[model samples]
Target: MIGRLNHVAIVVPDLEEGARVYRSTLGAKVSEAVDLPDHGVTTVFVELPNTKIELLHPHGEGSPIAKFLESNPSGGMHHVCYEVDDIIAARDKLESDGMRVLGDGEPKIGAHGKPVLFLHPKDFMGTLVELEQV
Candidate 1:
């Protein structure tokens, strides 16, 4: 089962500009950009009182984010991550309930260095859902 809201990911065409908007305009505390080659994204986390906002940029031509940006040129909300006590259990439960998991149905190390899984967007009302182990 899902736990607390982990973070909301937003795809951006420019990672630096996205971080700048959060840091300067919104006056938020932004973390340094980190390149996640496995995930094919360069990310910046905007810290907040309750949760974090993740700004993601495509890291390579084959990056999924690159494909997403091609469809949504200006970039947009990519996914909502929720915490889970046990990612495998959550994945099994969701699978049994008829929800489709993405990417070979295995957990991958996420930005927080926690195991994570992504569910199909169509199953979750057109919104991509990410489940991260807490």
Candidate 2:
């Protein structure tokens, strides 16, 4: 089952500008950009009192974010990540409940270096859900 809200991911055309808006304009604490080649994204984390906001930009032409940006040129909320005690168990439970998991249906290392899995957007009321092991 899902735990606390981990982070909300937002796809942005430019990571720097996204960070700037959160940092300088909003007066938020933003982390340095970290390139996640495996995930095909360059990310910046905006620290918050309760949760974090992740700013994601396409790392390559083949990046999934690039594909997302094609449809949503302005970029927007990509996914909402929730923490789980056991990712594999959570995945199995969701699967048995008829929820479809994305990708190969396996956990991948996320930005926080934690195991994470993505669920189909349609399964969760049109919003993509990401489960990260806490």
Candidate 3:
């Protein structure tokens, strides 16, 4: 089952500008952009009291974010991540309930070095949901 709200991801056209808006304008603590080549994104985290805001930009021509940006040129909320104590159990339960899991339906290492799984947006009211093992 889901635990806490992990992070809300925002796909941005420019990672620098996104970080600037969160850091300089909002006076937030933002981390340096880290390239996640495997995930096809460059990300920066804006620390918050309860959760984090992840700024993501396309890392390569074939990146998924690139495809997302094609439709939403100005960028937008990409996904919401929630923590889970047992991701395998959660996945099994979700599958039994007829929810589709993205990719190979296996947990992958996420930005925080935790096991993560992405659920199909259609299964969750048009919002792509990410489950991260805590």
Name the candidate that leads on TM-score: 3
Q: Encode model 1's per-residue lDDT on 1-134: one tens digit a residue.
A: 67799999999988889999999999999999999888888999999999999999988668878888989888899999999999999999999999999999999898778998999999999999999998
- State model 3's lDDT: 0.93
lDDT score of residue 115 within candidate 3: 97
lDDT of each: 0.92, 0.92, 0.93
Question: Model 1 misses residue 120 by how many Å?
Answer: 0.4
- Per-residue lDDT for 120 in model 1? 97
The local lDDT score (0 to 100) that residue 81 gets in candidate 2 is 96
Error of 1 at 58 (Å): 0.6
Q: Would you give me the overall lDDT of model 1? A: 0.92
Best by lDDT: 3
Q: What is the lDDT of residue 27 in candidate 2?
A: 100
- Clash statistics: count for each candidate: 0, 0, 0
Q: 30-109, model 2: which lDDT tens digit per residue? A: 99999988888999999999999999999965887888988888989999999999999999999999999999999989
Instruction: Give one digit per residue, the lDDT tens place, for model 3 in 62-102.
Output: 88778888889899999999999999999999999999999
